[model samples]
Target: MSRRGWTLFLAMSLIWGLPYLLIKVAVADLAPVVVVFGRCAVGAALLLPWTVATGQLRPALRRWRPLLAFTVLEMTGPWLLLAYAEQSLSSSLTGLLVAAVPFVAALAARLTGDEDRLTRVRVAGMLLGLAGIVALLGLDIEGAQLLPLAAVALTVVGYATAPLVISHRLPDVSGVAASSIALFVTAVVYAPFALPRLDRLDDASGTAVLSVVVLGLVCTALALALFFALIREVGPQRALVITFLNPAVAVLLGVALLDEPFTLGLAIGLPVILLGCLLATWRSRPRGAMPVPAIDAAA
Candidate 1:
């Protein structure tokens, strides 16, 4: 990767890592629906205009079926679940749990026919990853609530599956446009629930309010833009490696700012899970196959 690629890579690591902290802060006062609504609305407000101006909106709209599927999986369901889960689970724990996404994504790829095989290495990685989750749950069982943990589990599956929808079904769609429309649709869907709680914001703390703003403007909108740029710079495969770094940043921010505990489970589980993800997603090139071109961000 070039200097520019490294810069974008680092930026995305921090940007994507931030939402767990921000969501935790926002949900301290706001309803989970409100937080999700605000994030989607603000992100959509910013990106939809750009999509239209670039003429990407029409193409994205035409693929509404798959786009909506992507939206529900990626944003609508996961964001709500994350917010609700954070009400009980610490941001650090939530981030660490989500780090398992790559493990799930590896399985999802095979099931979706995006991957040709589920090799022994990947199966071993999955088992290792499952063990890490068991360690985290067993060690920190007191802190982890069953329902919220289940919510996070569902969120992980959604995050893992959504990208396959893009790679297989919406491969030619502009990522910016797909993301913009998804956010818009999510905001619209959640409006009924969120609007009723809008008055709650009047009593919310400055920190909570600012967290929502940052979640939308920085984490959702700006991060997506920079992520696309990173894909262009380093290719999608390398760009996706940011997943391994994001949870570390999330853990750091949670500990330093929120004073979230660095538990024994976290200490052990983090490394094991990350190593599992690394092995699970690793693809050895065939001896004489041509170098794969940069997969479009739609993947």
Candidate 2:
């Protein structure tokens, strides 16, 4: 990785990581739909114009079907579920649960015939990661936390599935355009639910309002743009290292700023999950095959 890659990696780690905390704060006052709507609206407002200026908007809109699937899978469902989950789960836990994405992506790739080989190391890693998930879940998988836990699992599936749609179905579409349209779709879908709750903001604290604004402008718009660039620069597989880093940042912020718990389960499970992610996503060299320099991991 170049200096730029490293810079983007760190920046994205924070950019993606902080959203957990922001969602936690935003949902303190705004409803889940409002948070999701505000995020997509702000993202669309910023990126749609960029997509047009870049002359990618037309091409992006032409692939409406796949793009819509991508949007619903990537942003609409996951973002709403994430916001809703944060209402009960700690920011740290939410971030860590999402760390399972690479494993899910790995499985999705294999299942979709995107990758032919699922090596022993990767399978082992998946098992290890699942053990970590079980460890984490054992701490809070009962009663009130059950629904949020399920929501996080589904959110992981959505996150894992969206990139596959891009790689398999919409590879030619501009990242900016795809993102812009996706935000537009999300905002439109959530408008009815959000509008009715708009009046509730009148009673929201300054912190809550600021959190939602940051969620939109920084987390949604800027983060996605940077994420696409990171994928371009480092390749999608390596770009995912951001996933390992984010939980750490989220945990720190959750503990320091929000005073959320640093639970025993997290301490035991997080490193295990990161290790599993590293192993599962690792590319092995075949002795007879020609050397292929590492590029982006296949989407």
Candidate 3:
């Protein structure tokens, strides 16, 4: 990678990696709905004007069906579920759990015929990924953790499905417009749930408030812009290195800052999950054979 590519790469990795920590903080006081609503509202507010000014919003909005589906799949359900899961699950575990997306995406791609076949390496990756999840559950899943674990599992499916929606149904849309509109729609949909809690912020700490602001402006809006540019610069395959890095960053931040537990399961499972993700998503062929570009959870 060139100097500029490295800059975008590292920036995006950090930007995307920080969200789990921020969500954990914000949801400590705010409702999960409030956190999602705040993030979508702030991100949409910051990006809408620019998308409109650049004449990208209207063209992208024309395909309303896929756009709405993408919004719900990518932002609405996953965002809320993730935030709610964080209420019971630790931030580090939440981030590590999301690493399951690639495994699920690989299965979705193969089943949908997005790719010709799942390579032997991908099959192995999938098995390893499953083992990691099993280990995680076996180690940490007593008591109330099961519910949050199920929520996280749904989130993984949503994250995987959103990219397919974009690749198959909304491939021609502008990235900026798609992200902005999806966020706007999410904010609007969650308005009723979020609005009633607006007056409850009096007891919330400054850290909780600032975390949501950062989640909205930095993690959502700025990170998506950076992601689009990174994809353009490095291609989607290379850009996905951030995905491999983000879970590690999330775990590190959680341990270092929040003093979250780094259990044996985290120690044993994180690397295995990342290895699975790498293999499952790896391309053995020449660069030219890569499929159509698509967004990921980074969006």
The number of the candidate with the highest TM-score is 2
Q: Give candidate 1's whole-model lDDT.
A: 0.76
TM-score order, best first, reads 2, 1, 3
Clash number by candidate, in order: 0, 1, 0
The TM-scores of all predictions, comma-separated, are: 0.80, 0.81, 0.80
Better of 1 and 2 by TM-score: 2
TM-score, cand. 1 = 0.80
Q: How close is candidate 3 to the true structure, as a TM-score?
A: 0.80
lDDT of each structure? Answer: 0.76, 0.77, 0.76
What tens-digit string does per-residue lDDT give for candidate 1 at 1-299?
56877788779888998888789889999999999999999999998998999889898889989888989988999999999999999875786677677667766766665533457775676666556655543425475779999999999899777766766677667778888899999999999999999988889999999999999999998886676566555543345556656666676676788698888866886677667656554455544654333433432
**Candidate 2 residue-wise lDDT, 131-210, digit = tens:** 66555435343445788989999999998778767666775677777888899989999999899989988899988989
**Angstrom error at residue 145, model 3:** 4.2
Worst lDDT run of 10 residues, candidate 3, spans: 290-299
Q: lDDT ranking from best to worst? A: 2, 1, 3
TM-score of 2: 0.81
How well is each residue in 59-147 modelled by candidate 3, as lDDT tens digits? Answer: 98899999999888889999999998999887756766776666677667767876435678866866676566555434354465678
